[model samples]
Structures are given as C-alpha cells and as structure tokens.
Target: MNVKPPSNAIPTTATAHAFEFSQVTSSAGEAWIDKNLGASQVATSSTDPASYGDLYQWDRPADEHQKRRTATITTLAVNTTPSHADFITATGPEGPYDWTIPNIGDVDDALHSAFFARTDGSGVCPTGFNVLTECN
Candidate 1:
C-alpha cells in the first residue's frame, strides 16, 4: 500500500482525539469523519494546527498516545500490542522506528507488515470500523 501519501489523509483524520469512529457513512458504505481525529476543527490548510489532530503510530490504538501533547518514549515496542501510551520516535534515518513497519522494509511501503499479519484493524480502529485496506 504505497499510498501516494495523500495530503487528504490528515485533513480526513480531527477533533476529539479522533476516537470517535464510524460517525458518518456514505451512500456507497464508506465511512469518513467530518473532522480530523484529535483535531479541534476541520482543516483549513496544511498549517492548520486544529486540524492536525493527534499523531497516530501506524496501526497503534486510539489511546493516550494519539494525543498531540502526549509524552514521547524513544523505545520501540517489542511486539505489535504495546502496553503503554508514549509516542515512539523514529531512530532517525538509521533503523526501524514504528511497530507496523518491517525493520528491513521499504520506507515508502505504507502497507509494510513484517510482524503485522492481521488486516482486520483490530486494536487500532474502533469496533465495527476498520483501517482502510489497500484495495479500498
């Protein structure tokens, strides 16, 4: 899923820490948010702070770590299900950083899943809603 890093991904994510899921549905059965997750308002521009919402680690759960002001921990999780809520920072352009990515995988591979084999979006997305698959 080398998604072209859509600029719309953020503006599509605000408000309320983005914990609210599946609040709206399209006629084609597509779900979307009126506001970016964790954002205070819908995005007006790339510099709109309110629309920045919270930063989510790929596949990470909608927990405290998603908060914009959450503390950062320089440690990477040993497993997919991290028990804590600290924003894990990338180890620069050196080594693996996040959980959803493979240690030796491509930097552009948005769908890289070395340890992540599940496609159900469990633990990350709210129940009844799932992270968009590559085919979506």
Candidate 2:
C-alpha cells in the first residue's frame, strides 16, 4: 500500500506545496500524493463529492472523462440516442456501448462478446501501469 506517483510524472511547484511526501511508514502505508487523474472525488455541482470518483460510460476512454487529463474522445457517438433493442444501428462501429444489445452471448457481436477487450493501446491507467484484465 505504499503510495507512489508514476515515474513519468513531474512534480510541479503547486503540487509540492499542496502535498507532503514522507518516507515514514504506518500500518496503512507510506503517504504520497499524485495528480488526480479522474479517480479523485471532488466537489462538483449536482454530484456527491464523497460518493465515488468520476463515473464513465462503458467503452469510453478515461482521458475524455478526467479533469486534469486532456480529453480525446474516440467514440463514434456523442449524444445520440442508443437503441433499446438488440442491435445498435445508429453509432456505427464507434460506440460507447451497452453490453445488452446485439446479444452478449453471440460470438459474432464482437462489441458484446466476452473476448472483446480494447486491443488498442488507448488504456486508462497511468503510465508504467496497465489496465488489469480478467487474466491478471
């Protein structure tokens, strides 16, 4: 439970003033601070600050939702309505998908298929870390 920032991260003057890093170990672990990469719960209007970190729609990359990080929206649809039925006919191949449609059980529906995980390198985790998978 030693809390360390990612190696690629830089410490800014503001960050240095805001956070204190210590080598002293407690039962919980060593204390450190890092940039909030959308995983921090902060006070925002219309949301509960203490509840959870930012909530993301499925299949959307974490970059687009995080505050400190620049948003790179890769989804095909932005605000379009999704299909209630089995097939997602509107958004084409780019999707922030719901696993219910086109049949999650069907092997041909790659989006809903259990085998489908992002093959693309657009992962959400910090540098030097990987998104944990079922295999891990």
Candidate 3:
C-alpha cells in the first residue's frame, strides 16, 4: 500500500555521493528510511558507525555539506539550495541559529519546514519516506 512517512525525513540521491535508501515501515503505519541520515547500511546497534551517518547541517538539503570532512561556515544562505557544501554554523547571540535563517526581511518559515516535512513538498526525501516529527 501507499504508506507515507509521518514528517521530517532524509534525502535519496541528493547527497555529495549518490546516497542509498532502504524502505522501512513503523508499527504506527508510517513509512521511513532503513538507515540514519548519512548511513548506507542499517545499524546493528546504538554505537555502530552506521548509526552515525554523515554530519551535515540538520536544516540543509543532503547536498554534500554534511560530509565527514565538509567545511563549516558562518554565513547564511539566501535561497533554497546553497552553493557551497560547508555546514552552516550558528551566527552570534541574536540567534537565527538555523541554516534556514534567511537574509533580513525574508520570512518564509516553509524554507526549513518544507524540506523536513514532505519529500515532495520541497526536499531531497525519497519517494515515500520522511523523518518523523513530534506531534502535539
């Protein structure tokens, strides 16, 4: 059947190197990835290296920025996709601490939400999978 993921998800082939995907189903009926964000294989335990996949910004696309050796930056992106793969670190105290922090006067919350919510909404998520978000 056509089970869609709940919310918050991972990308498919959008990462620096072609990422791999495996489908998994939850007890609650939500669909999901078989591995972690950067993992190529399923994890065997909590401390498995496969458990800790790539380390990119949580807000950006799977665009190579989260590579193990990726560069980190302080400058924010002005658009949906960033030109560089550097992980965008948080700026100063007046915190717009997410990579989705837009240029001043640009206030579209969907920037990050879209990517994290539905893969088709606006992100790199695979065909029928998404990361899970908390429900209130």
lDDT of each: 0.51, 0.32, 0.58
My TM-score estimates for the predictions, one after another, are: 0.53, 0.29, 0.66
Ranking 2 against 3 by TM-score, winner: 3
User: Would you list the clashing residue pairs of candidate 3?
Assistant: 7-131, 8-131, 9-131, 56-66
lDDT of candidate 2 over 1-136, digit per residue (tens): 1123333442332212122222222365422333222433333543555423343344434433433233433234432223221222234443444322333344354432222243232333332222223331
Report the lDDT of model 3 for residue 110.
47
How do all the candidates rank in terms of TM-score, highest first?
3, 1, 2
Which stretch of 10 consecutive residues in model 3 shows the poorest summed lDDT? Answer: 8-17
Quality of model 1 by C-alpha lDDT? 0.51
Query: Model 1: per-residue lDDT, tens digit, 14-60?
Result: 22323542244458645555555456666799898877766667655
Tens-place lDDT per residue, model 3, 1-136, is 1224545543333332355755656796555566666676777887887667776454567777877778888876766478878888757433656665545333555445555666563444555455454452
Rank the candidate models, highest lDDT first.
3, 1, 2
Best TM-score among the predictions, by candidate number: 3
